[model samples]
Target chain A: MTRARALLIVPLAVFVGIVVLLYSGFGLGRADLHPSALIDKPFPDFELPTLAGEPPRRSRDDLVGEVRLVNVWATWCPTCAAEHDELARITGETGIGIVGVNYKDDPNAARAWLAERGDPYLFHIIDARGDLGVDLGVYGAPETFIVDAAGVIRFKQVGAVTADTWRDSMAPVVASLQAAAP
Target chain B: MTGRTVLGITALCIAATLASAASLVDAYDFDNPALEARYRTLIAELRCPKCLNVNIAGSDAPIASDLRRAVRRMLEEGRSDQEILAHLQDRYGDFILYNPPLSPATVLLWATPAILVLVGLLVLRRLGSRRDAVELTEDERARLDALGAEDP
Candidate 1:
C-alpha cells in the first residue's frame, strides 16, 4: 500500500482498537464496584466488643461451624437504615445467622438504632474505630459477606442487601452452603 | 454597616479551615520528622477507597481516616514501606495504591501510550523520509509533454 494509505489505516486501526477496549470495560455489567480481596478466603479474624454493653465479645472463632452472614453497618450510614427491614425479613424468614459489625458508629446510637428498628443480628460486633472493617476490606457500610461452615467467605455483597439480592445471591449461596455442611 | 464584623468573621473562617487541614496531618505526630514526612508521602500515595478520586491524605472519609491510622500504626511498629503497602494491598487489592504495580491485568494500561507514541513517530519518520512531493523535475515534465503529443 502507498505510504499515505498505510498512514490512514494506522489512524483508523488505533481508533477502532480504543473503541473496543472501552466497550469491553463495561462488560462487568453492574456487578458491585469494588473488587473484593476477601472473596473465597476466610473472613478476617477479629474480636470486637459487643454493642450491648461490652461484656459479650464476638470473634471470628464464634462464627465457625456454621454458614452465616457478616454484615457491616453503622447508624451513620443511611443505606444501612434503608436495608434494615430487608435484613430483618431475611433473618426472620431464613434461619441463616447474621453477625453485625457496627462500623465506626457510636455505641449508644447504634444500640438505639438497632433497638428502634428491631435488631436482626445474632450478635453485634461493635467496631467503633473501623479496624475490623478495614481488615474485612470494607470501604463502605452495608457490605455483607457469606461465610461457609469452615469460616471461608463464599460470597460478598458490596452494597445494601435488598430482597432481590437476598433472593438472587445470598439465599441461594446460604442454602447450598448449609446443605453442603452437616 | 457591619463591614468590620464580616471581615473579622471571614478571617476567622479562613484560619479555621487552615487549622482543620493542618490538623489532619498533625493529629498523628511521628517520633521523628523523617517518619512524619514518610507518613505524609505514604498517605498521598494511597487512595481513599470510599472517596473515589481523592488520595487518603486529602480525603475526610472515615475509611480514609481509618487507613491513615493503620498506616501510622504500621510505621510506628518499624514495618518497612513494602510491608505496609503489601498489607493494604492484601486487604484492598491494587485499588488502594495510586500507582499500581505492572501486572498482566494492567499491561494495556502501562503500554498503550508507549505503543501510540511509537506509531506516531514511525508515521512522522515515514512522512519525513519521502520528501514533499518531489517537485516534478524539468526532464520529467518534458517527457510527459512528448508522451502527450504522441497520444494527441
Candidate 2:
C-alpha cells in the first residue's frame, strides 16, 4: 500500500511540476514580449521624411553618430501617449537622444500631438506607410529600440516605456552602450 | 422546381461560396499556376507576428496583409521560396515561421516528444519485467496444485 501511494505521488508531482512551469511562464508579463530578431543587427537602411518637413528626408546615416533610442510611435496609439511624458523625462534626465518614427500616422495629427505634448525626439522619421516599420520588424506601435553609436540595434522594448521600464531595463542598456562607444 | 434543377442550383451556390472565400484570402493574381501554389504554401507556413497562433493566410491584421503583399512581390520577382522566407525570417526572426528551424535553442522543443515517448517505453518495460519476475511461493504453488487436482 505504501509503495502504491508513492507511485501515485510520482504522477501527482509531475502534474504539479508542469502546472508550476506553465504558471510561471504566463506570469512573465506580456505574452507579446518575444526577443527581437534585430538585436546586434545594423539598423535597416531607410530614407524617410522627417516630421518637421523642413529637412525633407533623413537616412540611416544620420542616426549612426550617437547612442539613441529609436522609438516607434503614432498619434493613434494610446500607449504612446501614455509614455510620452516618460520619454521626455528620460531625455531630460539621462541626456540621451531619442529619434522618433511616426509609424503609420497622419502627419498633421502627429505634428499636432507633438505641439500639444512637448516632443522629446531629436527628430522624427515619418514612417507614414509603415515601410520602415516593417523593415524594423515592428508588429505594434510604442516599441522602442536602443541603437548604439555605430547604428547597431542593441535592444528593443516592445511596449510602452514607463518610468520603471526606463530605470530598470532600458537605462542600463543605454548606459552600457554609451560606455562601450568608441 | 424539379429535383434535378434544385440539385444544380445548390451545387452552383456551393461553388460560388468557395470561389468568394478563395478570393477573400488570396486576392493577388498570378499568371503562373505554380507561383500561385507556392504563394499559398508560403502564407500557410508563415505565422502572423501581430496575431496569436493564426497564420498570415488566416489573419486579417494589417501586418499580415503587408507580409502577404511582400510574399507576392517576391514571388513575382522570381525569388526562390527559401530566399523569400529567409527575408522575412531576417526581419521577424524564427517566430514568424510555424515550423521553427532546428537550432541549439530549439533542439529541446523538437526533441521533447521523442524524449517523453522513450521514457514512457522504458517505464513500461520496467513494469513488464517486474510483473514477469513475480514467482509463486512454495506454499502458494502447493495450494494451486491442490486446487488444480480437485478441478480435474
Candidate 3:
C-alpha cells in the first residue's frame, strides 16, 4: 500500500513476532539467577560419622569461627584425582587447612586416597552416606567452600581446586575473612 | 499423505506421549514434601551428561532416575542444599550445572548473551534510523501529492 502504511505494518509485524517468540520461550532475555548462584551463602548442615571411626571430626560447629577451606572430594572422582596434588601443595605449603569431605567413597578407597597422596587436611570427614555432602550443596567431588570465621560462606568453588585459582580468587577471600573477623 | 508418512507421524506422536510417563515413573518415593522439593531442585540442576539435552530432573534414563533417588535419600538424611549440590558437582564437573559458575572456561558462555543482545540492539537502531531518514522518491511524492489534493 502507501509508504506510511508499509512503515507502520513492518514495525507492527516485528513487534508481534517478538511477542510470539517470547511466549514460545525463544526470547533473548537473560535470567541471571540459576541453581549454582547459591555460592557465598551459609553452608548446609550435617553431622556424619568420621572416617576410620575416629569420631566425628567436623560438624556445623567446625565451620563456625574460622576461615577454612572445605574441600568436598571422593576417591572415585577423576577430577578429584587430578586436583589432589594441587590441593596438597596449597594446604601444606600455604598453611591453609583444607577440610576434606570424603563423599560417598568406600572407606577403604578413602583411606587409600589419603595414604597415596598424603593427608593435607587437618581432619577428614567421611560422607560415605553422602549426607554431609548434600548438606553443603555438593553436587560432586572436588567442590570447595571458603567459610569465614563467623560461619558465613565467602565463596563456593564448584570444580577441582587449583594452585593458581587458590592464589588468585581464594586468597583474597581469605584475607577478607580475616579482616572481617574481630 | 502416503501410508508410510501417516505411520511415521503416528510413531512420532507415540514416542512423544511415552516420554512423560517414563520420566514420572522413574522418580522414587519421597513421602515427605520437603525431601521431594529438595530432590527436584537437585535433579533440575544436574545435567544428564549422557542425554545432553535433558536435565536429570526431566530425563528417563535409568542412571538419572537413580541419581534422583539418591538425592532424595540425602535430603531425608538431613543434608543441606549446598551439601547435596556439592555431592553432585563432585561426581560430575561444573557441566552438571545448566549454568556453570563464572570460571575462565565458562566466562564466555555467561558473557556472550549480554554482549550479543547489546550488539543486536545497536544494529536494529541503526537500521531503523536509516529507514526513518530516507526521503520519498519523486514518483511516490507525486502520487502522495495527488492523493493529498484529492483528499481535500
Q: Which pairs clash (backbone N, Cα, C closer than 3 Å) in model 1?
A: none
Q: Encode model 3's per-residue lDDT on A52-147: one tens digit a residue.
A: 567645577865777888888888889998888898788777677677788877988888878887887868778776555545545556778887
Arrange candidates, best DockQ first: 1, 2, 3
Clashes of each: 0, 0, 32
Name the runs in model 3 displaced over 4 angstroms.
Answer: A1-36, A129-131, B1-27, B30-53, B60-152
Tell me the tens digit of each residue's lDDT in model 1 across B30-104: 678988988988999999887668899888887889999899989999998999988888778888898989999
lDDT of 1 by residue, A3-81 (tens): 6687678768979998999999878643354566777878778877888755678778988889988899988889999
Ranking of predictions according to TM-score: 2, 1, 3
- The sequence of per-residue lDDT tens digits that candidate 2 reaches over residues B16-62 is 98876675584787899999999999999999998869999887788
Output the lDDT of residue A40, model 1. Answer: 81
Q: Candidate 1, DockQ to 2 decimals?
A: 0.49
User: Against the true two-chain complex, what DockQ does each candidate achieve?
Assistant: 0.49, 0.48, 0.06
